[model samples]
Target: MASAITTLAADAPTLSAANTGFMLICSALVMLMTPGLAFFYGGMVRVKSSLNMLMMSFISLGIVTILWVLYGFSLAFGTDSGSLIGWNSDYVGLSGIGITELWDGYTIPVYVFAVFQLMFAVITPALISGALADRVKFGAWVLFTALWVTVVYFPVAHWVWGAGGWLFELGVIDFAGGTAVHINAGAAALGVILVIGKRVGFKKDPMRPHSLPLVMLGAGLLWFGWFGFNAGSWLGNDDGVGAVMFVNTQVATAAAMLAWLGYEKLRHGSFTTLGAASGAVAGLVAITPSGGAVSPLGAIAVGVIAGVLCAMAVGLKYKFGYDDSLDVIGVHLVGGVVGSLLVGLFATGGVQSDVAGLFYGGGLEQLGKQAIGVFAVLAYSLVASALLAFLLDKTIGMRVSEDDEVAGIDQVEHAETAYDFSGAGGGAASRSTAAPAPSAASKKVDA
Candidate 1:
């Protein structure tokens, strides 16, 4: 029966139903990460801006999904034009697609692949929302999300994953999105923050997170979804590789959280809930690129190093004077680089591909490739995001007015608050409304 099982799997058709179903479920798991991100980011900001932060991530779901079906997927995953881009427009609106037709190499249908990739496209831009929290114009951000993904994300994704992409040809190991998603968004966050400038009270304000529980909840969801994020990148559930990635993902995140708490105790004399949440995310980001390539021990090393490095890196914003509002640059970009580069150090031939890293005797060749991949995406995303942001700033404007920012972005941008504490605990509270602010006051004058 075991031999029969092996024979059956080996003989399975290219359009294997099992692989298709697995891909579809993984797609759902990947889809959950965006909202997970919304919650994660929402809880990090002041209470007044929490809803806007959530919307920053929520809006990407709508915008990127629509664009992906229309043309984004085609540009990112369609057949190659050369090394820089994928130019087939046939996938626009998914034309010529069949319900049962297998995608290029996998048993999953083309639509399944499209949807899976769609989730990645959605979250990549959402990742930047954290850096720009509390001060961006919603319209301008919406426009920027649309444009930045087009120019920076699609092409870079093509470079890393699409056939004939220079990076793919060069043998860069981005297993999932170390370069395309995390590092790309991280650098873009830095660029746009440079263009938008700092928050009004970045240095002086205490600016503590309004709800650590919410952040912890969100981080928990991300860790849950990442099982799909990393393992699903395999595009099938056929072998030990997926299981290895799953184990690595869990262990790395666990190790990172501990490392972060340890670092926090040493640095601040306490272990914080915020540190725990942030550390888990740092591990997720770090293992994303290198997980499939490294051993379980290597995963622990990656996690601990990432936890320590990212914990320290977050402080750079203050020293360097950039207001990375939610530490996107520090955590994602820094963690991504750590993971991608570590592939060169920890990759073993025992895993998915035959490639081995330094510890396993593969040398620095993979490391050099990883470096090239990182720099290329970083430079491109920075330039493109800055240009896009600068143009938006010059045209329809990007920053909210100083008054709106201080008063609260939730009210300024969305006219709703995240919480109505006024309604808490009683009868009179039932009639309570949002406390009047400038935007609300403007209504009185107009009336």
Candidate 2:
């Protein structure tokens, strides 16, 4: 009977080349999100460091991509090792695994999956840098990403996605990385913020976004790319499930956008562009965990709730004095937790039999399980992240000098300015003019 079942499972039609082709396209779509994130973050920072902020995310594409191809994939999803890490035997340096090797009953290629997953690995750590923008050394960030991916991200990824992962064994259904991506990155963001300290001026400066249009553009790209993110989690273009997830993704984001704007208008007397962008992200984050599990109505609820909650949570940085510059904690960490927890209550019977929420008559048992999962991931992520930051700080130093910061990281660290309007070859005037004034209020004001 066991062999018969195995035979049935194996005989199931693998994802066709066309399906794999779609997934590969989806992966590329997801890769675009990092640059979208760069724009999103770049526009929000003071102009002095806008280019630097953008560079942070772009650098991850280079650094993490190389690392993933080398050994990152091995540590993340190669094979199970005691439920903690993955073994190096399979797919090391892309060895032995060929286009024929089946992944999730897909005949496409394992390498395709590896490359797709690599994009995700590249972007997750980049998401955290928003909280510590304009302060840390570029060199230090390079080192931090290199170390963080190896120590923090890869292990958590293994635990959630690997064959023998603890979370996988425990029946924790993440659907698309509520715990691994958002929560993990959010927790790490909190740690880095604690270690790196606040931006130079922080609260007193009214550091409004330099380019609202850029933020909106980034948000738009992220929304477009996220279809791949949530839908592709199914690992194949099998049925209507992908289409369902895609639609939910759109609805939830729109609902959250409205919810956030409404909340902001109620509290602050005006709805800023920043609020709109942040709300869209909050919706996206909230729906990530529950998108595949819930119905369309549930997606709307999750999105709206996450939007309002995260919109309010952004103020917590000022009230509590944590200095999460762009509200990584407010949007990702808090949004992720809210969505993850809510799925326990709103998940319908269509997603899974073992999973049902409070409203679905599953009672508090599932909620308790969700709470436990949330706390466990939060606690583990927080401690692990702090230690990683501390160790990196002690070893390679985590911050740049005040002089370098005031001068701007683009010229100081990378020896290149994002723009060259004057076309001068590295002159003093060029350097001086390249750096925007430190006072965020003095820059361009939008009507």
- Report model 1's TM-score to 2 decimal places: 0.93
Identify the runs in model 1 with alpha carbons over 4 angstroms from their true place: 1-13, 426-447
TM-score for each prediction?
0.93, 0.90
lDDT of 2: 0.84
Q: After superposition, which runs of candidate 2 have C-alpha atoms over 4 Å from their true positions?
A: 1-12, 104-108, 352-354, 419-447
In TM-score terms, which candidate is top?
1
Write one digit per residue (lDDT tens) for candidate 2, span 372-437.
767777788788788877887888888777888778767777787766666557778777777655
Q: What's the lDDT for candidate 1? A: 0.92
**What C-alpha lDDT do the candidate models reach, one value each?**
0.92, 0.84
Candidate 1 C-alpha lDDT tens digits along 1-447: 999999987876578788888888889999999999999999999999999999889999999999888899889888888688886767988887888877886788989999999999999999999999889999999999999888999999999999989999999998889999999999999999999999989899889899999999999999999999999998998877988999999989999999999999999999999999999999999999999999999999999999999999999999999999999999999999999999999999788799999889998888899999999999999988999999999999999999999999999889998888864664676448636556867988987
Minimum summed lDDT over a 10-residue window in model 1 is located at 422-431
Which prediction has the highest lDDT against the true structure?
A: 1
Error of 1 at 429 (Å): 16
